[model samples]
Target: MMRIVTAGYSRHTRSYYSNQAHGLKYFLVRLQTEGFCQALVNGTLYTIRPGDLLLCKPGDSYELMVQLGSNEPPSGDYFLSVELNEWMLEWWEDYKQEVKLNVGVDEMLISIWRHLVYEKRRVKDSNPDIMDYLCRSILLHMNRLISGGVSSNPYERSVSNQIKMFIEKNATEPITLRDVSTAVGLSVSRASQLFKEAFNQSVMDYAIEVRLSIAKERILIGGSTLQEVSFLCGFANYTHFNRSFRLRYGMSPSEYRRQVRPQ
Candidate 1:
């Protein structure tokens, strides 16, 4: 399961830094809105300017040395930070090692960051609802930034991910590829293509796999009849469930349950 931790925005600046560094305990991401910050990332000096973003991992040593412009105020720089979940940390580590952000800054993401920070500032004392919305917006923006040139692939993966989440949430209800596709704004054919590309199976095939797995678990518990387990796992009727069970397991659901469960 994935989880999201603390998320917020802040704008601050420092000047003429003495040589100092903190033992990084969280992923540090800074979107520079104005001015610049000289950072020592992995012992390399990177001069980050406006519209630039810096990505840092936990325990990575870095120091910030901001250079204020002559026209810029004494404290003109701004940044935002969010502590990452463990899964997020693992994803970042993989990204840093593989994906190169060596290209010039992306203006679109910077604009998104600016809008998010402004939105965050607007409802400081009240509006928890708006804050929650802003967090989701930020997440989507970051995902777009990281997705790179794979236009249709991300859409495919997103659809599949949404379907899996929905299936897990509504395991006891009947579901179909058409249902999942409509839920994520795609046609059944497109959803099937995407799901096959990502998961190596058709949507209905995957759904049946999930259903049968759930049915097997229920049967082993010995509380429900085979028909009842089939219904609970979202099969339409007893014969259909029995046919699927025989095709997959080479035996009826009852026989499999009897073989697995102690007398």
Candidate 2:
């Protein structure tokens, strides 16, 4: 089971305050919807603008500094944090190969995110399954553009097609490197290596990402409880779900529901 947790949006007002320099932390995916900020990772400065995404790995020294840009107040920037658990690790691998940071938001992703924002606003408590489904879809939509490049390498194209088919065929099953290997007619280790090379993710890692993505939908839209969702989603137990969910959202499953539920 992939034990990932997510943190929802909580806006922070910045008047040019400096955060204390800290050691490396968990993976940080910064989505800039408004305003601009700069992140200094080990003396290298990177600028962030609207639609830009930034990744920060744990244990890496970094600092976040925000300032007022052309826009006044800059209060609408959205920042979310999710711990990169096993499933995320796989997603990251594929993502690193296929997607580039700071790329403009694809129309599909924009639509999904708009829906998520709308849903989040109306519900005081959210169904864990629904939240998971929506969030996972948002993430995948962002990655799909990265995966669908114009490259013509036969091997890369093959890998991409296989992955797509695999995801569609087994949306409800636990995806495994071994399964991909068998489907692709390659040794397990060889399959892992090629997948990492072409998609920037091991077969197992991508599998977890797919499973998590589907589980989120099943739980949320299917109206399944955490236990049922976990069991059906390929998690070993509820404890595993709690840990992963907390890490990804910065709140437990129950808390997420309470936070998103309409009063």
Candidate 3:
């Protein structure tokens, strides 16, 4: 089981300082969504900007400062602290989690973080199961963002990243290959080949992956039926969504919901 101790968005207009000299008690993940701030990460002070991520483990020294300069914008970030269970411990050890990373400001990533914050605000009504899954989703998504740039050529990497960003933002719409290629100023064949080489998957295949991920989040949040979720997530119909969901998750959406939700 996963446990998220705290999750929220913070916006600081005035200066703010948080010094944790005694070390952190839980895993801390913070993403600078807007403005800028300085943080002492791993004994080095760094200027954190939009799209910068900070990952800190327990017993790590962490400090954050927001000192606004003349006409400087206020600092804002989405932050969460997690109490690692056995599974999370394993996942953490599997990757060499860096203190800071330049993961771009991805809309889908922000959406997931927003959902986690909203669910946390539910307090007594909040479902721990939902929080658990959302936190896991966020960590996994961050990992993917960190490792997605597989190309060594700087131009190829930039183009591939642009294609991914386009797909992420438009996956909920009825987007096509041509749209993706056009967004990145590449032809269909060139964009397709670039994305496949960079991510080891076809463009349409990656689109389905994004769709199913959105559907899963909606399904877990409830209120909407399976068919509605399918359409809302850009699936052609329930049948296709159901088949894809099963193929990826090994169970139908309903079964997944039942298993993960509180009875």
Candidate 2 clashes: the total is: 27
Those runs of model 1 whose alpha carbons end farther than 4 Å from true positions after fitting are: 1-55, 58-152
Give the runs in model 2 whose Cα sits over 4 Å from its true position.
1-20, 69-76, 95-100, 114-124, 148-263
lDDT of each: 0.63, 0.59, 0.87
Number of the predicted model whose TM-score against the real structure is largest: 3
Could you give the candidate ranking by TM-score, starting with the highest? 3, 1, 2
Model 2 over residues 129-227: C-alpha lDDT tens digits?
655566678667656644563444544545555654565577457666677778767787876665677666655555556656665666456467767
Candidate closer to the true structure by TM-score (higher is better), 1 or 2: 1
Taking every candidate in turn, the Cα RMSD to the unseen true structure, in Å, is: 10.8, 16.7, 8.1
Cα miss at 7, model 2 (Å)? 4.0
Clash totals for all models, in order?
A: 0, 27, 0
- The better-scoring model by lDDT among 1 and 2 is 1
Clashes of 3: 0
Cα displacement (angstroms), candidate 1, residue 15, comes to 19
